[model samples]
Target: MTKTALSHKSASPWLEDMRRRFRTLPFLKATGNTVFLFIFFYLYLYIQRNPVFEVTQIPATQLDRWIGFQPWALALYLSLWVYTTLPVALQPDLKQLTKYGLHIGLMCALSLLIFVFWPTSVSAAVGPREGGGMFAMMYAVDTNGNALPSLHVAAAVFSFMWLQTIFRSVRAPIWLRVVDALWCAGICYSTLAVKQHLLLDVIAGGALGAVAGWLSLRSAGRGKIAG
Candidate 1:
């Protein structure tokens, strides 16, 4: 057989396996994750609008100024919703999906609790730009509260960790992993680029995500989900 034919034959099983894995529990996973998103957003917006304590302002760093505002990065910032759902959609079974949800849900709960007691916001001087469009609508709805430990960055990193594990388990290509990393990085960067979060918020959010992802994977036996 030719080398091309041999390579194709070798790659077929993992590709088929990945397809089968993704096909598992599709409807159930989508519905459950969607419902969780709605609940999370409702709680988040409620907390944002009604902070019990004085909202601490997060200071921008030189990095923030260097990155500056990029109106185009809004697409990357908003892509976080779709990015976060990929792992849940690709879970191989109900047990694993449930476990993933629980871990992420707990992380969000902790963040929400922190929001309640120690609310934070972006510096007014560097807030989202003024103008009518998606940015205006986003700013109107999201406001400046819940700034520290950006849930946007946290969710992106959490999804990144889960996706890397999933891809490794399926023997996905190295390029696929690189794309995953780039996507996660873009989402994290967008938080700052759009002036939605400061440098400190991104750092804290990344830390929160790493800790939660590590704990979740550890509990899942290093991402080995039994059939």
Candidate 2:
């Protein structure tokens, strides 16, 4: 076979193996779902403990920290900001949708779970504060039970980390990755700038997203492509 055809065949075995395991490997098939369930179970038990919000602070007085533009932090936060889709858009397929859903569910559930033991703050300080357009609304609707995990940031970073899929599937340019990385930074800053979350919250969110994204992506198997 030619090099191109040989390469394709080489790739096909791994793809076939992954697809076959989807049936034989229940854990593989439902890794995302399993994660979602654990997170949900954790939250279910956690509520009995009753979470509370505590206080924390942003590091900078002049606005803009992340330890003065922490690289990964900036990339994760900005990618999330640019890529977040509106609720009304055309829905993704079941597999992709489930991944996204599980990511969100896991973040929110674990965050709430963590809060029961180690509560953190909604804002840097407890006070009457000026709020922005969505900020006030988010604050009002936001549960006082959990704020530290910054589920929004977690979800954002989850999607950002999935950027590789976009490139792999579409043959996207390298600049796209760079753009997504920049968005990650913006999303993190926006969390603090908009008063949605603190620095610690951003860190926790990024970490959670990283783990969940890794687990979800590792198990995503593709079916055959017609020649």
Candidate 3:
């Protein structure tokens, strides 16, 4: 009986640490959210490409015209996937992970709903992806639909906001924040530069992302207070 009691006492700290680590696991939640959003995004693309929907081409504004076409921006545009995946490492707690996933899920849902009901396409001429290179591959997979509210921009904005919060929580350096901010801004501009979205689409996407980010943060705060 004395030996058993001593063994249990020695194991208690290990058990408690395991529990803490389990609660803080962010990769599973982030991966789950990523898969779900991608499937839904594919569905949105299908709906947009369907011939049954009345696809209205959104005309570019004067601002859109001013935003020159820069094919090199494709690198920055594709970097959004990497930017979004950073949360798996940066999220320090279950609360932060929850908020990040919720923000992305909500952002995708709202953007998809708009795409389904009010389908829009880009009117501006995007240079042909004819070389069968990286850009061609991207164009092949990424259908030209869901144009009004750029999900790319929305995702970038939502991701950066959550990342900012996470950085604050971890007391990350100011340089990290600056780099993140610059990256996010580059992603936003890349959308326009690549001709994937117009100026208005970017504006609306940014607004939606901001609202969703704000809501997610508010919800997380309330949860903390209630707890």
Instruction: Estimate candidate 1's alpha-carbon lDDT, on a 0 to 1 scale.
Output: 0.87
Q: What are the per-residue Cα lDDT tens digits for candidate 3 across 173-223?
A: 788789999999999999988778888788988998888877877777733
- Candidate ranking under TM-score, highest first, comes to 1, 3, 2
* Regions more than 4 Å wrong, model 3: 1-27, 123-132, 222-227
lDDT of 1 by residue, 97-210 (tens): 889999999999999999999999885646446556998899888986898888899999999998888888877789989999999999999988888888899899999999
Worst 10 residues of 3 by lDDT: 13-22
Q: Mind sharing the TM-score for model 1?
A: 0.92
TM-score of 3: 0.79
Question: For this target, which candidate reaches the highest TM-score against the unseen true structure?
Answer: 1
